[model samples]
Target: MILQNKERIVIIGFGPVAASLVEGLLPAVTAGTIELIVVSSEKHLAYNRVLLAELAVGATRAEHLGMVDETRLRNAGVVLQLGRTVKRVDRSRRQVLLEDADPLSYDRLVFATGARPTIPALNGLNFDPHSEAQLPHGVLALRTLEDAMNLNKVLQGNGRVLVLGGGVLGIEAALAMAEAGHRPVLIHHGPAPLGRVVDADGGTLLIRSLRAAGVEVISEARATGIQKDETGFTGLVTQTHGIIEGAALVLSTGVRARTELASSCGLAVNRGIKTNEYLAADIEHRIFAIGDCAEVAGQAPVGLLAPGWAQAGWLAQYMLSTPAPGPADPSLHDPISLAPPSLESSDVLMLKGQGLELTAGGDIAAGLWDESGSQVTVFADPAEGKYLKMVSQAGVLTGFLAMGLPRTSAELVLSYERGSMLPADRSTLLRLDDPGILEPAGAPGPDDQLCRCSGATHGQVAHAVEAGCTTVAEVGESCRAGTGCGGCRAVIEAMLKTPVPA
Candidate 1:
């Protein structure tokens, strides 16, 4: 892992995790130890994939989603190859053949190849994706910024949209289309749209919220096929509900890890490229992988951004020196292997769109708690669009979910993550209006985070305020607390109101 002067370190993808790795590797490159080459198959520079739905909804333009500054990247002596897809990887020769350009050589290759959208074998989407597949006239998958731009173009025609799949992206896309004055029908096979994320109560209330925001949700309807008439693609043909007519279709099915190039080069790949604790694939020691595409066997590939970011941080640090103690080459013969990629973790999902404000995570239903013999607490007020459910085992808050209560959701997420003990009177936890009744036993420790989006802790935000950050905007400029999704602005303002410790 020792990087010699001018070491050619070629990263395959330019997604968020790879950008993070490059950001970490930037400081070390001052001595010219590594020659960095980032090859992106995408035509445009790397943008925030998570906020592309917002782009489609016209909340923000495409220019706002940029992850890295091109001028700064150029100043760091980094080479960016846009619109270049790797046609093949020659492992023995240490070179990558490009489709549009000549081959490029690398001393050590890193695969940050991210995931691609999973289109079901439905009548509309099933086809060979590699051989210039043509989807139905107006059907598209909201995978990249380019896709978002195409969706916006469709929106301009004031076309009625038939959004397939009931995942997060599907909901957001439908809501965006609805906001742009198009009536979009949301069809889901499950009884509740987000049954996996929310409980029965939360799901009901979510339906209410969506309806109030002018979104039409059709539950328990499985689409059998996409019908096309003489005009073109008509709409969705469901088994039970019959045809739901619309002008266009957008599919938001989940994604699979993009591991085609890795598999082509004789590397072991299951759902993702197999790796060990250090994230070195079973191939060469210098050859490594990270992000959504890399999987430590026995563990499913983490499709979320946080775990991939953690993996990149570790892999970037691990690749700076000599290899870890073990056989540099883990055998590819064993496909179902296990690597301790990270610590035990949980993800907080925020329903992101123009008007949908909901956050859910962990075991979030009474039925789930009953199976584990854990105590369950519940609070439901559908009229006000609030639902709170908590799961406790041996006096520790194990899992919890709060909807329509931003403050409670943020605090509950912290409590679950820190494994905090619940108060003796558990019922008071849902008292959102009376902050005194629901307050924790003590103030957060200095290391405790006040804003997860910006990685600002109590100490950091407090110090920034103490250094004369008088307003939320000023604080955001100083520490980036309220700048992201604006979900943590309330917490930041409250922190600013208190006597911040040095």
Candidate 2:
């Protein structure tokens, strides 16, 4: 679809995806090629929902989490309509009807309405007083930043907090509440905490960590109902056990894709709005879905912020450019695969090229293994909760995983990928610290995979430089490297200025 000058684009949901799209369209918006309108049910502008746990712990203020600056958005020609919900979409007329406003027509409609927290049905349970509608004052579910702030206010006074579910959000909330000096009791029907994302061992480790942090965890206990008293919440009824007392409850059970608008408009709805590889919904040609609302390849929404950011970038590129032949390549879009958090404990050994050259050795668990039979070693302590694992075989480093250490892993991985020989001993490897390690070596070639997250090879980046791709953004556009975690960005820039060896 060719976007004409003065074409109107209306976006629903003023969350991360929508904000990102608007920020990306700044050039087009400034040039008067597109007119944009963002409709949000929230009263506040788009904010970072990923940091809600931090908000709960009081680490970050509520206003600081906003994804976009309102002034910047306004200056870029985006019309902000907050505190309004889209009642219905009349696709035939190409207009969206808001709850209290006249129908607004659009040249293109983008569904970034996002997902809401899924509050399960329980008997005799009333919504919390701070809830949006006051269905009951006994149950509280957090999805929005406002929800987190309200829950934080309610949790201020001394009271028992029974957090339901043991997923990432639940664990995060439980940890945050515990850190805030609130005694939180976690209930999960699953076998362990973070059961969906992490493996059994990793979950066990996480549960142990939470318990050490003073959280009472109950697994295999499903919340069946809630009992309330005149003062507030009274008790929680579980399937396996009888009722347990509680002053307040925070439900972190899970979330479903917010598809009310899509379903109401008669779009193909499964657990989420089904989208092709390009993130475009199967029903609407012009409309697309991204972030938590779109389901790709039957995978349940991971709800992590990074994947959503990647999806939004890809969608923006596709929307702005001509239609490419065939289905959109999944390889082009790097959705982080849902792997269990690594919990290995073994001694890490590294070999760069030939001879038993020792780079950095550490203790790692046996579980974290590569395709080869060699076990990953971790030099860092698991008890202190700082771990590093690096894998190498036949005088070459294959893979490395480090939780807290940043440049160590990046340097080691770069050395391995470039087939550079490691320092003779552990002391030498450890002594060669940060800024020095990033310096280009005379022997090693520049075309090494410095960042494994994006599979960015130095050669492809060098080629971009030869092709007049002078800036990092230009290189990213040309080769799609250094775009994921961006940890190697500084290294890439450093390499650009260095001269090649004869």
Candidate 3:
């Protein structure tokens, strides 16, 4: 007897987070255990938003940005609905109200609402939040493919551009525009560029790197208003300084969790939709939230894509391992733990940008430093535009900054993620292009997670290799590593190059 009928699963949003969710549900979906309905507000097919910068500068085309192909969805029997907004979520009826269609009922609801770009509330900048507009010509935000398409038009001209905000997104935008042969000036509110991740000294090095790439980094300035004309956004006006003229303005101000839909339905709300470690919404155990829009209270949201993928895996396990309830099931009175048994401990950030390599996370901040217990070491070479910071706690590695150090950036990311103890002579770890000395240096440890995007471990990849997978593509096909974000492609290639010890 069927313990429970196939679950009617409805997933809202189709970004990386939602894609990860689909990856997790693929097994069940293919097994005829669940009916998947993915509803996204984006009109286009699911695509990787991380590479929008490349699309803007003419490096990559639109066809390459897509994340999901229709053939795969059709084979898996997934109902992929795009360009539709969920106006209302009725928790009582377990239904979602769409703007141009009928209600989508679900036995389980996944709120992967993701985030929306922050359209700065500057004077003369008018954006109606209720409706999605084509973003009048000239004004741009590097958040979506449509914005990137419009930006491509702006990049075709040899005109100067003004970029607001100095975070990772802003930096990438400025660099891309500069590479496109346009003069790009970056205005950051902080004392230096990339203030949040890098300290004053590290940020100084970042500015130099940006400058070397033809980007003008303006520090300690704030944009009070924006100037507009009949054409659209014209330029930016600073607080004290005079107007900064530009042919167009690109706002990479950052993003906020989209919580209106969940909040309107009487779900618990915090900085994002409140979900437990298992990603189950507090409103109902069956209702789950993930990605940039969901966070556990007292813990900062893992705005990056890795945590969302991890949560998707955890939810998949929760669904598979738990016994399905039969008729007269007491599931309503008793709920199950949906969070992963043990999520990855250390925070990891390996930002993606061509020519500019920077990986900072896992207690890399100065505030996490304590003279009595931690060692903060730094080295910078202006000639090579490289900066490295290794924060060690009680004789073990904690966090680091590997900016412009191309060779060891991926190594440092993996080491930090693994929480492996630093070797006695860790100065070698700071040395560029040298593994120097590691407690276990030859190959990735069996327990180490090699790809954060796919949560594939070293052992898994090695097993695939042992099974005659000689190429990165073969390994990705064998174990599904390097399939998300494409940041780990280099790491996978490095693994292929390293010989197995006899």
- Which candidate should be chosen as best, given lDDT against the real structure? 3
Query: Candidate 3, which ten residues in sequence have the lowest lDDT sum?
Result: 323-332
Off by over 4 Å in 1: 1-5, 127-134, 179-181, 229-232, 322-344, 352-356, 365-372, 435-444, 449-486, 489-502
Model 2 residue 370 CA deviation (Å) reads: 17
State each model's CA lDDT, in order. 0.73, 0.63, 0.75
User: Per-prediction TM-score, please?
Assistant: 0.85, 0.67, 0.86
For model 3, what is the error of residue 297's alpha carbon versus the real structure, in angstroms, after optimal superposition? Answer: 5.5
Error of 2 at 125 (Å): 4.7
lDDT of 1 by residue, 219-260 (tens): 998887888877567788888899988777787777788888
Global Cα lDDT for candidate 2: 0.63
Give residue 261's error in model 2 in angstroms: 1.1
Model 1 TM:
0.85
lDDT of 2 at 276: 64
User: What is the overall TM-score of model 3 with all chains considered together?
Assistant: 0.86
